[model samples]
Target: MNKTKNNFIYNIITKDLKKCKHKKIYTRFPPEPNGYLHIGHAKSILLNFNIAKKFNGICNLRLDDTNPSKENKKYVNSIKYDIKWLGFKFYYDIYYTSQYFYLLYKFSIKLIKNGLAYIDELNKHQISKYKGNFNNLGKNSPYRKRSINENLIFFKKMKNGFFNNGKISLRAKINMLSPNILMRDPILYRIKFNKHYKTKYIWCIYPMYDFAHCLSDYIEKITHSLCTLEFQDNKILYDWFLNNLKIFNKPKQYEFSRLNIEYNVISKRKLSILIKKKIITGWDDPRIVTLSGLRNRGYTSNSILNFCNSIGVTRQNSLIKISFLENFIRKELNIKSQRLIAVLNPIKIIIENFNKIKEKILIPNHPQNKNMGKRKYVFSKEIYIDNKDFKEKKTNGYRGLTIGNKVKLRYSYIIKAKKIKKDKNGNIIYILCKYYKNRKKNNVNGIIHWISKLYSIPAIFFLYYNLFKISNPENKKNFIKYINKKSLVINRGFIEKNIKNINNFSYQFERKGYFCLNKNFKNNNIFYFNRIVKLKNII
Candidate 1:
């Protein structure tokens, strides 16, 4: 491990290991494959994967794909793809909790035989009422004293698809009056008649997440079962199941707070509803931060992994600003991505007197990186300036060229718009300008980005904004009520001819935004460039 700038959790784990306390560290990311993975999942992935790597240990890609009601093969595959994309290489085989269904069932039966577990015949509401408080403890189940043979017979029928969903659950026979309510005979298995993707209809009963989680860890010999803070309350029962099962090398669960992002809700249910209602395009909607979504919006995997490392691991909850992520992406791209020009909202600006150049002018792709090299672009007498860059009325910080004002065309000549053309709708259609053609002294506030009018590349520029109106609305409330209706405002514009030669997957539209190739790109390319944040505080 490159022990460089000491990251927080690494230091702790390093110190702990130096003491010669624990053997080779083993970590696992056990996600329930219910929905698409998000940035929060990225944090967990980095934490677990990094821990294993830093200690020369191992990490397991274990899917808690037990509940067939919500799980699917598609989600399972996506989870695998995402983990690989984030640069994690796992050791041993990928394990699923369903793989342990037979062993888990046998263990449950053994518990029943030992008077350590029993079949709770109570309905959902009755079970909830009896599952009591942290300090007050729980009321005992009426059927807690059923004989092992009788419980076994009912449970066998349960496995044979005899019981309806929620009709019966195999529960651990822990303390009813225990202060820790999770251990108050928690449900170990439940009847879900739905066919599992992996197991099919071989077993009707599915193991609970808590039951399957620790058992799978022990079975895999995971030294550390890393989890989020929400699972801390369930640790009492986590320990109970391991002790009851008498599994060797029981994995100890350590809880850390899951990541929360501003203006973005991380709940899978909320994201699903948003997609269903057409609130956003889909899970990867650029506005939402799913892995595919981030990739679509041009976030590098390296930046995401670095962002996770920058955040580090901690038990304390963190509310990371979306800026933190944006910074890293920009940082990575600054060295990697070339600078090109594409004006999103366009107004035609003409040079009244200038060299009638319609051919390509070679410009360095990225100024800092010579290895990225140079490409040719069209510089013409007539071109497009952002409509917003020009105004009939002027404001205080307005540095752009309005009518009769002089400004530099980037890497070219300074020009002044002498006249303007307007359509029937009173929209400014074109600008007539005079260019200064000296071997020149620098002039104009800035060379506000300009695109060639000739050798046109049909690129669609995007002024992407947040999807949510409220940064953080109240929980489970009508978040959709605050959806930003104009999150995406598209503009058809032209870029320099050099950009026409750019490999479509990634490109920068200089002062305008960052763009990538659309999967459905054609010769008459429809370029989709998301505003990679704003050009330094335009908002």
Candidate 2:
């Protein structure tokens, strides 16, 4: 059942725990709940949950929901759905940093009385002025000299909603000369009047990430705080907070490089920008990296888990070619997904001078998996094939349908293109063909999957392309300039009659791709199927 069996990482983790005398290891994936979790989040999710499962421990799905400005109930709900879709189960103990607001507030009081923290009335601009470049010592805040009593009283009113937004912040009284800007008197709390989806408007001040995250891990007794490479620099601050607070079960922060894909944007801010600029649709648009987008496009959790395992954990920051990930999906789906015949680009061909009784074709549901059984398709005089399948002239490696070229209709007899009809616009509306009496496999240069004209299944094939145009769409640079104009090219077409009853949940249009039945499937079953990726190239 395990794909990456006996991997070194597992052995290493086991040995480390034994040395530390850590009986049970606890890990967590703390997303901010601000945006739909993307592929990067999927990596972190699998790392946390799968590692816990491997070691017979628990992994908490904590909503690092500290930033109220960018978070919402919708995003929180989406995060839950996505995590579950990826095959994770969490208890009612599911937590939000907001849930610990009072506890965090009390903790802040502890720091204040200990002189480890003080409230500074420096607005953002004033704070930045004192926060010198890492090489230079940050100028101290004027309020740094405020007496403990005055600072505590002001902090209480700030907690009680006395401070306007951005007026003041609770800064950890760390070294202002620290080389790391994040540790150079990092802001622990800020005043925001926004309504939290979970806490509502009860609290005016929210704990900043560095403050709430470390405390949350400590409170939950998390053994390890797994994060992406972006937080590697913040490890110092994480350690300082724990060491100074003298937390008994201080969890260590370990960072791994976040997985990035070519032609994909994983940043929440950039994703929001894409939506706002109308470069793409909403977060769940199939083109987006959100789990909902992948779900809509027919990617299963098993496939995703397998894909993540194949990549493994690494310290190096690298952007993997999208092809590598897509390839993994294709490999798994090809073996499991049932195959059907669906034509995305249709061109009708009518057999002339050969009138015969209605013919039915029995096609194997799956080539190797016979328990899946077979289904019947119809054979009629007039059938539509792909236009690209046929060519009036041959390309470099042409073997598909072409003018006067005889091609087998896959599981049926051979047909030769005879004549074509065009409207006033001079476009081939349809092609006329003649059928060979005794056709067998390998009798011709080309054989293609096709649906019968008389008993065809009407389907919509929504072909998908990569989400972005640039190879590294997740780079810190601007992404608006790299919109892939052809990200989603919608095509409505038909498949063989036998495919009509096939389970729409997961299917592969034989020699085409993996796809899912769209939500709008109706009585006619005029469903939409978004191609997960081409079966061959994807894996």
Candidate 3:
């Protein structure tokens, strides 16, 4: 286990252990199965599971599948996959809030029989108006004075599907004038006719998140319910549900700042809109920050975990620069990824003075690690280099190929530019060069990567940029308007032939950025590679 830094939550857990507040600690990651997990979800997963591992406790994976209207089995499976992909194992069988529907319904009944709850006939808009804002106190509903027997009969009718969807809602008869708006008669149960993925139509009325969350925690015996800072206000209602029920061993709620990366949106609603409008391919689009998307873009689980740990746990919300997350993967791939030569903007280079048709050259897979071994490539009479690496008219300090200067081809002999050929439009189509035979170092302008025309493999490269043009797209009234049109740029390229057998590993494409085989790659004639990150951090 990696050593976790002692944060405020860690200190609290330690004190609880020392004081024997509980024999063991329990933590859970409860996610609504409405969409794919994002990087923000990763922070919670690591914190909960890591805390369990640190103190010899247990962490459970609980699916808050209370909202059947948007929940499904596919998202549940995805949530499980993401957690496991992040290298975490839940304590035992996965738990679902739907599993405790009976208990939760009975708990609501207990509240109603004790005269602590009542039924409200207010519509959605009316509920909002009565809830009031922070500036003004809310007014109690007309039904708040309903007799206990009347409330129970109406609640039973709601459970029996006698009430149409949104006709009537069972609410906790808390304070309507309370300062905390959430506590001002929050909805306990609502009628939803949508079929649940797990329970199907057996449940017409489902418990609200606030009602099911704390009760589910108590039933599961969760000791510490860790959540994001946005729930700091909801903590009051979270406790209210547990406290009113008078349940022993009630889990305490703790909040930490959620991971918010600039230029990204983790909100499920916004993400769904992006998909609906085809702003992105899907949740796994390489430009997205969703866990599946990051994994598809060649991010390793270790790099993500390290990034989460580096940020640590805190209560204050702040926007993290996207480079901070990119740096972790960049550093990890630097040591682990193999080096391969590729030319995205191919400009042909013909070595006129070369004696042999082709010769073999060996290049180390990694510069600093000899044990990573080397791969052989064909240095032929004709080769291709990136167009950006040459200049017809040399500027000051130009290090690439020019009329009078020599440049070194990586893992090959030095070559000097002698002449160039142009197309009908006066564009340089290719360059003619003469190669030196001696394996001796020469004063070359710069070293450049190339692939032999005879041995080069045709491939397509997908270069991804930030999906949003601005740092914070959510600030705009219409975030979609700020979507970067050039987020994905495709380039036809050539990679070394040897890369065919090494599809599983990420590679640094020599001077180009790090890349990995696209998850959708299948054709042998043309390979597809996705650019993971740049060779270095670029603003």
lDDT comparing candidate 1 with the true structure: 0.78
lDDT agreement of model 2 with the native:
0.81
In order, what is each prediction's RMSD in angstroms?
A: 2.9, 2.5, 2.0
Clashes per model (N, Cα, C within 3 A): 2, 4, 0
The segments of candidate 1 whose C-alpha lies over 4 angstroms from its true place after superposition are: 1-23, 132-138, 176-179, 354-360, 370-373, 439-446, 473-478, 520-525, 532-535
Pick out the ten consecutive residues of candidate 3 with the lowest summed lDDT: 1-10
* Residue-level lDDT tens digits of model 2 in 1-539: 35445444456568778897578888888888888988888888888887788888888989998877889989989999999888789944788788788989988888888898988988998899899995678988988878889889999899888879999899999888887899789899999999888889998999988888989998888887888788888888888887877777688777777888778888888888888888777888877767877777777777777777777787788888877877777877777777887888888888885697468778887898998888877778878787778887757777787777788888888988877898999888888888887877555768887777777667887778876667886764867777778878888788666555655467878778887776645557565677888766431
Ranking by lDDT: 3, 2, 1
lDDT of 1 at 80: 90
Report the lDDT tens digits of candidate 1 across residue range 305-396: 88877777677886778778888887777666778777777888877776667746677888788887877767688788887777765568
TM-score of each: 0.91, 0.93, 0.95
Off-target runs (Cα >4 Å) in candidate 3 are: 1-5, 438-443, 474-477, 537-539
Candidate with the larger lDDT of 1 and 2: 2
Tens-place lDDT per residue, model 3, 1-539, is 24355478998999899999989989999999999999999999998998899899999999999999999999999999999999988779999999999999999999999999999999989999999999999998988999999999999999998989889999998898999999899999999999999999899999999889988888888899999888889988987887788887889999889888999888999999999999899989889999999999999999999998888888888899999999999999998888888899899999998878899877888899999898888999899999888998889987888987888888778999999999999988789999997646578898888899999989999999999999988667799989999999999989888887675578888778899989787896998999999877432
Model 3 TM-score on a 0 to 1 scale: 0.95
